[model samples]
Target chain A: MSAVEHAVVDQLGTAEARALLMTAEFGRLAFIDGHGPTVEPFAFALEDTAEDTAIVIAVGTGSGARAAVGQTVAFEVDEIDPVRRTGWSVVAVGTLHGAPATVTARPEPWPDPDGELVLLRLPAERLTGRRLRRETRRAGRR
Target chain B: MSAVEHAVVDQLGTAEARALLMTAEFGRLAFIDGHGPTVEPFAFALEDTAEDTAIVIAVGTGSGARAAVGQTVAFEVDEIDPVRRTGWSVVAVGTLHGAPATVTARPEPWPDPDGELVLLRLPAERLTGRRLRRETRRAGRR
Candidate 1:
């Protein structure tokens, strides 16, 4: 009989978490809207500032995301292999704000048939990550 | 020169959104933590009751997700093709609650090295989704 595989979850440190965040160009942004708490996927780019790294996203002027400015939000990114059921996820918590004039490395804006686009930045105030690894264990083993 | 491709975003209806949600086995759950808002990935399954569908997840006793019970939360799932820059994302907003004994279709719990596991349920009060499609346009075309 084939050995059963179980997942082992590991917590990642700050530096390791930030390193992992840099590897993905897309993420889900969670914020509160009129209805309630909601999440939307966005293309993101990391910018290095004098103090820390910031996540930048470009959205249309009429986008509900524009309202997220000044609000605390969570940005999450992950890479999962469904067949293997193994992956790592990283979440950055911070306040969303309008981008400064000096900001660089903006994500390419999705074509907006509505109006112009604007850039929003979120300084990763706190970072946490976890990795799930599957290991083979003999069947019936506790 | 080859035509440039631009992303076109489309909003999906409720039936379409729920159907898309059923196609994925994993998703990110966003909830408010002690520090602030945060997100974590988890294995999830959809359960059908007489009235509506519910999203179910299993977590260890020590899991922070337990705290999310009774609070409004957002569960998001998406499938993105990095190379093609095309995919769909669905988000369900609802209050988290402890699973009832009558509930069925529990997700397989991730191995917990610490303790026992429990199931949590979130009845998808509201469902929303969007799809990104890449369409090629001739150069200099508006």
Candidate 2:
């Protein structure tokens, strides 16, 4: 059967979304550069605080996003079953900040580094997500 | 072994990137809304012409991206091997547009539709990608 034939969509809460975000090791970061809106996949670590949750990403010194410091950014993570069309996607929107020198719990950057790698933060301002499920529905069901 | 131990990153050409993008069934659409930069996963169909390669997405009438007509946007698709630390990611930057009524080819929209659904196009202006691979280095190799 086709995926759309039995798909159901549900919204997820911030807490649940954050929990899912933590489980995924990597996600895509979306930001604006001189050309336009762009996306790049990167590995990230999460930092939770009493007030907010932020994402720590390791980027090369030459990365375009490095120049996008202090700008607004969105990081997205999702798990989808292409065959069944069931999955969940979460997005966190926030301002990008360089990690303070005091923090020492940063995750290791992927593809290993050649030169210096800098850590940038996307302090969580908004967290939202949705889950899709495939379920057969009975006739006349509301 | 970890993905970073022998990882090498390579840039992909426009044709190769577009080909990789066509292999994936779904991708994340990055756009700006009232709040800030946001990302939403979407299923898409590709149309190639002498002029440009356009991404046609089926979205609900109530979707946020539907309101982003004529705005610059980015669509991203990637496949990564967490264990092997190898995979490829492609990003397509373009301007969003409403699809013409005459078009017939469209990918099925996910989560099922409540009311009417519309087809939106992101006419790709730039297509870029990168591949990560592992190569064991000899002890004597620099």
Candidate 3:
């Protein structure tokens, strides 16, 4: 389900990146586990407090749950418009960290000890984004 | 363009993955550089050898050119589908390998120099993928 059709790399303000992240419900977290690399799907909530910091919180029981903690991770998100044949993606790679108490206590559905909530405060050491352009013909231009 | 609207992971074959990668002229290459981590976008060509491997070949100048040689790297390709409200992505994290003579002769275009024709061999590691599912009513009878 990966559409790598078109992409353009650009850097935006951390605030803007945080807002763009909020528009999505989930993302694929990529990490290097054992002998090779791995990617996992997780539900995440983005929080923008510092100018260059964001928190992606997720709680799961999968192997990725434990390994992701205290490790370098990459979060990949994309929004595609099939009809328009256009789309874009943004990637933020940083460290997996814990969340603030006040932030965790909010309406967030982070898994409690009942399941264990794992959080990652993405410092976003690197952020690369791309947008795909759709072919368009001017009026009366074949 | 980066698709941040809807994204879900799904499993796919090398062909399905290659199809998406080829449609787009460029994708990102990530590696553990001497300086923490680095990611760069490059144009590549995919060759499905008789041997169960999807090869991605790319070339560059001083930028990431030589750095990629003989090193292990991960290449990511993705897109977003608005109508479907889902994101699709494919990542091949393997060795940054050299291309066969034939592959080297006929390289792909990057729409720019520094961007060379690189070759990636998809051991077809993990066909990890997904897509977001939005609720939609079934039939009128229902």
TM-score for each model: 0.93, 0.91, 0.59
Residue A121 error for model 3, in Å? 2.6
After superposing candidate 3 on the true structure, give the runs of residues whose Cα lies further than 4 Å from its correct spot: A1-28, A39-45, A50-52, A57-66, A76-91, A104-117, A125-142, B1-26, B62-66, B82-84, B104-107, B115-127, B131-142
What is the lDDT ranking, best to worst?
Answer: 1, 2, 3
Q: Estimate, for each residue in B40-65, the C-alpha lDDT of model 2 and write its tens digit.
A: 88888898767778988988754688
Question: Candidate 1's residue-wise lDDT over A1-142, tens digit each?
Answer: 6587778888899899999998998888999988898888888899988887899999885457888899999999888888787888899999999999998876967533346788899999999988878888789635
DockQ agreement of candidate 1 with the native complex: 0.61
All-Cα superposition RMSD per candidate: 2.3, 3.1, 9.2
TM-scores for chain B, listed for all candidates: 0.92, 0.89, 0.64
Model 3, backbone clash pairs (residues 3+ apart or across chains), number: 51
Instruction: List, residue by residue over B27-76, the lDDT tens digit for candidate 1.
Output: 88899978889887878889998887889999886457878889999999
- Give the poorly placed runs of model 2, Cα more than 4 Å off: A1-4, A139-142, B1-4, B140-142
User: Candidate 3, residue A108: CA error in Å?
Assistant: 9.4
Among these predicted structures, which one has the highest lDDT? Answer: 1
Write out the backbone clash pairs for model 2: none
Worst 10 residues of 2 chain A by lDDT: A1-10
TM-score winner among the candidates? 1
For model 3, state the Cα shift of residue B84 in Å: 4.9
Tens digits of per-residue lDDT, candidate 3, B17-136, equal 656656655455666555444554455556655654444544534344346566655666655443454555666766665665544224343322334444434344443433334333
